[model samples]
Target: AVLKATGAKGVAEPAAVLAAGGGRLLVKKMKWKNVTVAIAEISNPLSVSPNEPAL
Candidate 1:
């Protein structure tokens, strides 16, 4: 199966690998003040990466 991850730490490697396999990588920032919650409005942003596959 394909792999997935989120946030800054997950922006590389896995994202590239998944994209290379024809997958979109969804990324969002986690809110750390109160709890671990997503508070961003982003979508399949891996298209900019050199190794990511085209949409």
Candidate 2:
């Protein structure tokens, strides 16, 4: 929800994001309760962390 509000894309599957070359976007690893969430920021003008996997 937070990611959506920020105009970012929320990918439920990390593999999918990596496969789509979304590693350049701002990606965040969050944890809520027992679930792990991956949030990608597509609105950012700069690229995300280079260390991130490209799938």
Q: What stretches of model 1 exceed 4 Å from their correct place? A: 1-9, 22-53
What lDDT does model 2 reach? 0.54
lDDT of 2 by residue, 1-55 (tens): 6486656555554643564455443455676786756655443325657788543
On residues 1-55, what C-alpha lDDT tens digit does candidate 1 reach at each position?
A: 0133433443344544444453443444354555443222224444467686543
Candidate 2: which stretches are off by over 4 Å? 1-16, 41-55
Taking all chains together, each candidate's TM-score versus the true structure is: 0.24, 0.31
**Clash count for each candidate, listed in order shown:** 0, 0
Which pairs of residues collide in model 1?
none
Q: How many clashing pairs in candidate 1?
A: 0
What RMSD does each model have against the real structure?
Answer: 11.2, 10.0
CA lDDT scores, all candidates in order: 0.42, 0.54
Weakest 10 consecutive residues of candidate 2 by summed lDDT: 39-48
